[model samples]
Target: MRIPSYEDMLAAHERIKPHIRRTPVRTSDYLNDLAGCDLYFKCENFQEPGAFKVRGAANAVFGLDDEQARKGVATHSSGNHASCLSFAAMRRGIPCNVVMPRTAPQAKKDTVARYGGRITECDPSTSSREAAFAKVQAETGGDFVHPYNDPRVIAGQGTCSREFMEQTDGLDMVVAPIGGGGMISGTCLTLSTLAPETKVIAAEPEQADDAYRSFKAGHIIADDAPKTIADGLLVPLKELTWHFVSNHVSEIYTASEQEIIDAMKLSWKHLRIVIEPSCAVPLAVILKNPDAFAGKRVGVVITGGNVDLDKLPWMQT
Candidate 1:
C-alpha cells in the first residue's frame, strides 16, 4: 500500500485551505496541572463540520474533476466523516451519499441531512457498513472516500499535525485517538518528516483496542462490533493506516470507558471545550499514565465535538 508523503500533505493543506478551517491550538493551566504536562489541544472540534474529518473529506471532494464531482462522493462513517463529507460535497454543490451505522448518534445523522446528503443505515459492524456502502456507491456512482484509509484522506489529515507543529514549538510528543488510524496515520506522516525528534503516540478505547493489539502483535487485528462509549474508535485499522502505525508510532495506549468519560468531562469543564468521547481517549491515557507524560510538552489532537446533547454518556441512568 502507498503511503502519503510530506509533499502530499503540503498539497492537501493548500487544496483544503479554502474549504476547511485551520482550527486553533488551545492550552489550559488547569489541564496542565492535572496532567503534569504542558498539554496543547489542537481543537479540531471548532472545525466547520465540528470534526477534523473535514480535512480529509474536503481534500477528497475538491480533488475530483467537474465531471467526477457531478456524480458526487460516497463513504461509510460512524458520524463525523459522514457529516464532513456531506458538508464538503455540499460546499462544491455535489451530491453526497453516506452509509452509516443505524446506531449512529441522531445529531450526526441530522448533520448529514442538514448538509443535503442521503444516508443509508446499516448494522453497527464493519462488514455491514462495507456492504451497505458498496450498494450506495453502485447506485450513486459517487467517488469513494474511505474515511481513514484513502491516501488522499490520510494526506489531508497530515495537515493537522503540520498546523499543530506550526502553532506550538518544542513539542516532545503528539497524541491522538486511534480508530481506523487515519488521523494517527496523518500525525505519523507529518511528524515523521517534519518533526522526527518528536514521538507519536496513539490512544485507543480498551473496549475496542484492536489498534493496540495490532501494534503489539506486529499485524492488523480487527473487531466486528466491539461496544464502547468512544463510538468513533470502534472501526478497525486498514492496510494504509497499518503501514503508518507500524512504522511511525512509538506507543499505543488504552483507556477504559469510564476513564474516557472522565477525560471528556474534564476537557469540557477545565478547558471550556466541547469534545467527543473519542477525542478524550488521548487525555484519558495521559491521565491514566501521568508518569510517561510528566513535564513534557505534549500535543493532543481533539478530533471532534459532534455528540448528541440529549443522550450524553454521562447523563444516561
Candidate 2:
C-alpha cells in the first residue's frame, strides 16, 4: 500500500474539485465559550452525499481507467461510505456493489439503493463483511474500493483538510473522529504537510477505542464485536491508516456514549445541523476534556449528518 504524498493528495483535490462540495467552516461562540477556546467547525454533513466520504469515493471512481471503470467497483461500508460510493458510482455510470451488514440501519440501506447501488446483506461482523466483499469482487470482477485503506481514498480524504486549512488560519489543533482511521489519517497527513505546527487529534468513543489502544500499544488492535452509537466508528484501524495515525497524530481521546449523545443534541440545537453520534465525537472530546483544548484555537470536523430520525437516541426517553 503506497501512501500518496501531500502533493499527490493536493492534485486529487484539483481533480475532484468540480465533483465535491466545499463544505463551510462554521464558528460558534457558544461552543467557544463552553470549551474556553475558539472553535471552527468543518461541516461535512452539508457535503454532497452528506459526508466527507464522497470526496474519496469520487476521486477513486474517477481515477479508475476506462477498463477498470467498466468493471465497476465493490466495497463493504457501514453507512456513510456506502452511500458516498454508491452516489459517486452512479454519477460515473458504473455499477456499484456494496456488501453491507444485515444489521445496518434502514436509512443507510435506503440511501445506497437511492443511489442505484446493489446491496448484498451479510452478517454485521467484520469477518462476514470482508468475506462478502471478496465474493462480490470475484463474481463481478469489480475493483475493490476499500473504505479507509485505499491510498486514493486517503488522498481524497486529505483534500478536506486542505480545503479547511486554506479557508482558515491559526488553528492550534484539528480534531476528527477515528473509525477505520481514514478521515483522521487523511486529516492528520494533510495537517502534517500544510500546518505542521497544528496538532492533530483522533477522537473515538470509549466503547470503540481501538485506535486509541492501538496507538498506545504500538500495534494494530482489533475489537472483536464492538458496540457503540457511533456506528461509523466501530471498525478498527487498518495498516495504511495506522501508519498515518501513528506518525502524524498528536494524541487520541475517548468519549463516552452519553457524551456523544449530548454533543449530537447540542450540534442540532446550536449549529442547527443534524449530526449523527459519530459526527459528534470531536465535540464530545472537547466537552470531556476542556482543559486539553482550553486557550487553543481548534478545528473540529463534523463528519456526517445521516441518522434515523424516528429513533434518535435522545428521543427514546
C-alpha RMSD values across all candidates: 0.8, 0.9
Clashes of each: 0, 0
Residue 109 in model 2: shift from native, Å?
Answer: 1.2
**Which 10-residue window of candidate 2 scores lowest in summed lDDT?**
308-317
Assess the local accuracy of residue 203 in candidate 1 as a C-alpha lDDT between 0 and 100. Answer: 97
Ten contiguous residues with the weakest lDDT in model 1: 308-317
Error of 1 at 226 (Å): 0.7
Off by over 4 Å in 1: none
lDDT per residue, candidate 2, 69-130, as tens digits?
99899999998899999999999999999999887778888999999999999987898889
Residues 1-317, candidate 1: write the lDDT tens digits.
57788999999999999988889999999999999999999999999889999999999999999999999999999999999999999999999999999999999999999999899999999999999999889998999999999999999999999999999975999999999999999999999989999999999999999999999999999999999999899899999999999999999999999999999999999889888999999999999999999999999999999999998889962
Q: lDDT for model 1, please.
A: 0.95
